[model samples]
Target: MPEPPRPEQPSDDKVLRGLVGAGPSQLSTHAALRARDASQPTDEDLAEAERDLVLVRRRYVPTQNLPPGIKPAN
Candidate 1:
């Protein structure tokens, strides 16, 4: 008599996520999860992002040099 066919194995994405106790909709694949973890912002990356937001004035004028009517504090 012929033997019955075996059940299909789950994909690597499903198997790996299941092993890590992650929900089904969390990540698509193990490699993608690893990549995301590895690509987290470092201290340098944070500093660079902050630096990008800073506005550097090309020319500086002292408060004493301002016009009489204009108040720099206000």
Candidate 2:
């Protein structure tokens, strides 16, 4: 049998929006993975992480995308 085509991944903006909407615990884990791991992430991982951070900051509070701030105006 032929293999099925893989589904497309969500765009970075969409992913980050979901992450920001996910709230604190999720954000903490994401921050920890990106921050605690001193080892360099691959180009893709690094880019994703950077995008996550930027989106999180903008969408949430100034204090590490925690809460109590305005999300993107969409």
Candidate 3:
């Protein structure tokens, strides 16, 4: 059997808008990851937090597509 084609990745803006419980200034999963792991990362703690955040977000949040009950905001 052949595999079905995957849908395209949504724009970063759309992803941010669709994020549940996200604040307007809050960074996206990837952004947070960069923040925490970067040399500065506002020091270091935030970088570690951001790295952990990436893991958590990848597991729970939608990346290229969303799971049920996680529809994108218009």
Candidate 4:
């Protein structure tokens, strides 16, 4: 049997430019987000976030509560 066709990939130069060609403002925003993510969260903050997530998961929202055009999973 014949193999399926593969999608065309971007050239290395194109990929390189895409990563390196961001404007100063975009680069600064990216750097700030990276710095924030690199910082470790405190134990108290982690605990509170975990508690909040548990509460959110425990609260049942019926399918009817979902916005229009959004279907529930099978």
Candidate 5:
């Protein structure tokens, strides 16, 4: 039998809003869920999400848009 699928990530709308309006917590949670081994997402999909998360980190990791000391519990 084939391996199980990965979990579902948040929708693009939520992702965009979370990335733009909210902090990195939402994005990190979505990433963790997508990384799970049950949703059967393709490698390409995972790669794309990884790229998006990297870009997000680049945008916030330095300037630290998050509230002071409020780290995404990822």
Candidate 6:
């Protein structure tokens, strides 16, 4: 039998927002569900997500230049 049509890949902006610290929007979450159902996510998608995640994590972390005994400000 002929193969089914593959689902469309997510836009770079959507993937970046979803993977990073930003919470997923309803539309992006729905798109991800569709992609998962269709098994259409590509390696580039995964790599981009990983890259964005690292960047997001670094952005939120406190700077390391504080004095040894200094605690984070409330």
* lDDT digits (tens) for residues 1-74 of candidate 1: 89899898988877556657645555557866787789899999999998665343445546445545544442
> What TM-scores do the predictions have?
0.32, 0.27, 0.21, 0.25, 0.22, 0.24
List of clashing residue pairs for candidate 2: none
Best by TM-score: 1
Between the candidate structures 3 and 5, which one is better when assessed by lDDT?
Answer: 5
Model 3 lDDT tens row, 19-57: 544656456689767755664645467877865543334
Model 1 steric clash pairs:
none
Prediction 1 global C-alpha lDDT: 0.67
Cand. 5 TM to true fold: 0.22
Pairs that collide in candidate 5 are 5-38, 5-39, 5-40, 6-38, 6-39, 6-40
Better of 1 and 4 by lDDT: 1
Each model's C-alpha lDDT? 0.67, 0.62, 0.60, 0.63, 0.64, 0.64
Model 1 segments beyond 4 Å from truth?
A: 1-28, 54-74
Supply the TM-score for candidate 1: 0.32
Superposed on all Cα atoms, the candidates' RMSDs to the truth, in angstroms, are 13.7, 13.8, 21.0, 15.9, 17.6, 13.0
Model 6 Cα lDDT, one tens digit per residue, 34-66: 867777658998998876553324335466654
lDDT of 4 by residue, 1-74 (tens): 99998988978776446547775433357865675687779899899897664333344566546656644444
In candidate 5, what are the lDDT values of residues 1-74, reduced to their tens digit? 99899887878887667656854655576675774645687999889887655443533455556555556545
Worst lDDT 10-window in candidate 4: 52-61
Pairs with backbone N, CA or C atoms under 3 Å apart (clashes), candidate 4: none
**Count of clashes, each model:** 0, 0, 3, 0, 6, 0
Worst 10 residues of 5 by lDDT: 53-62
Error of 3 at 47 (Å): 14
Candidate 3 has an lDDT of 0.60
CA-RMSD of model 1:
13.7
